[model samples]
Target: MEYQEAKDKFISTWGSLGTLWGINKAMAQIQALLFISTKPLSMEDIMEDLKISRGNTSMNLRQLMDWGIVTKVLVSGERKEFFTTEKDVQELARVIAKERSRREIKPVIKVLDEVSSIKDDGTEKTKELIKQTKALHNLTQDADAMINKLMDQKQNWLTKSVFKLIK
Candidate 1:
């Protein structure tokens, strides 16, 4: 495919994938645009290129900053702010994984800990509920550990030996 077509396809696919993960399409599109650009982009540039409203672009950019994947930059003599994404894919994945774990898994683990700690009321239903919550707690904890290990890995952490260990 041609250059423009390939770029558009990438942005659209990325936005759709993000939507599947419960993120808004506009945010994903903005991220994709920033990632593909060689230099940091101003709000006007992003708005014009993506055809997004000013307010929508502002909100998504703020959210991206909060997620630690995007940053605001000040040019040497320019007044307006520009934005850029963490272009290193490995670092980006590490940040995203940590954020999602904190947002998603941590809460479930906390709730499971609370509910599972309740005294047994002796009813079969209550007993089952407690048992299941404990199981969920264990599973989430394990996932958290795996994510931590994966994030802490260095450049060559994934190897034939790693696959063998998993297998």
Candidate 2:
């Protein structure tokens, strides 16, 4: 298809995928747009391109910046801010994995730790809660370890080989 059509499809798909991952659709759309753009875009440009309001664009851009997926670009001689997306897929995945681990997995692990450490009351409900929390803690800890390993592997050839083999 044509370039614009392809971009539209990409934005739509990315937006939907973002929703599935608990990210706002508009933020993902803005990310997709920046990812495909040849140069940095201002907030106004993003608003116009996405047909979203200033507040919507501003809020989403802030969120994306906080997540490390987007960065602000200060064009020389220009006062308004510009934005760009991280284009490297591996880096993008690393950022997203780290962010999710911090936001979701870490808190769950904390709760699991607290609940599992409680002194046993011998009640069935307490036993069940402890058992479930322990299991969740183990699972989340494993996931965290795996993510850490992957992130640490960065440019290691052995790590790349292992990842390929696993895949």
Candidate 3:
């Protein structure tokens, strides 16, 4: 495949993958663009190249910055801000996992705690509710443990975990 075509395909594929991770299409597309760019990209450059609207580019860039994956840079004497992403794939994945654990998993764990705390009224339905919520709570706890391990380790978390398990 040709250069531009390959770039387009990569951006599309990455953007589609982002949707599966609960982010919007434009956000993922912008991430993919920043990932492959050698230099920082301005909002105008991003909109023009991605064929996205100015507002969309602005909003998604802000969101990316909030996620700590993308960051803004100043161009010497230029007013417009240029953006770049965390280039290391492992570091990027770790950051995303930490953020998702904070924003999404924590809340689910809270809800599971509340639901699992319901008093036993001696009904089959109540028993079932408690049982199911307990199961969900267990799963969330495991997820939380994994996220914590990922965030705390500097390198080879999986390898360390495997060794720990065997020992």
Candidate 4:
């Protein structure tokens, strides 16, 4: 396939995969574009390439920035804001994992903790609720802890080893 077709296919596939990472298709498309670009792109450039509205592009760009996956880039001698994304695949994965842990896993753990801490009134239902929630809370905490440990060891030998194996 030609460069244009290949690029389009990659952006489309990446957009679909974005849902798995808790982002919208357009958000993912924007990131994909930025990821492959030789330099930063302006909002107008993104919208033109993606055929999306200005509002949609602007909103998704902000959301991407919030996730720490995208950033604003200043171009000298230009007024329009340009944007870029994490270029290193490994670093990008690390950021996404850490953000997902904080935004999604941490909140679930907190709620589970609160629910599990309810007083035991000597009823089977109450006991069962506490038991189940406590189990879930423990499991979630353990998973989160594991993720945190992995994050702490960013770019470590083990991580590189795993990626090398996969590749």
Which prediction has the highest TM-score against the true structure? 1
lDDT of each: 0.90, 0.89, 0.90, 0.92
Once model 1 is optimally superposed onto the true structure by TM-score, how far is the C-alpha of residue 151 displaced, in angstroms? 0.9
lDDT (tens digit, per residue) of candidate 4 on 1-167:
99999999999999999879888899999999999999999999999999999999999999999999899989999999999999988788789989989989999999999999999999999999999999999999998897777666756745576568978
Candidate 3: tens digits of C-alpha lDDT, residues 39-117: 9999999999999999999999999999999999888988989999999888888888888888888999999999999
lDDT of candidate 1 over 1-167, digit per residue (tens):
99899999999999989955457899999999999999999999999999999999999999999999999998889889999999998888888888888888788899999999999989999999999999999998998989778876866456646667988
TM-scores for every candidate against the unseen true structure: 0.92, 0.90, 0.92, 0.89
Q: What is candidate 2's CA lDDT for residue 60? A: 93
Record all residue pairs in model 4 with backbone atoms less than 3 Å apart, i.e. clashing.
Answer: none
Residue 106 displacement in candidate 4 (angstroms): 0.9
Query: Number of backbone collisions per candidate, in order?
Result: 0, 0, 0, 0
lDDT of 3: 0.90
Give stretches of model 3 more than 4 Å off.
158-167
How does candidate 4 fare on TM-score?
0.89
Model 1 segments more than 4 A misplaced: none
Model with the higher lDDT, candidate 2 or 3 = 3
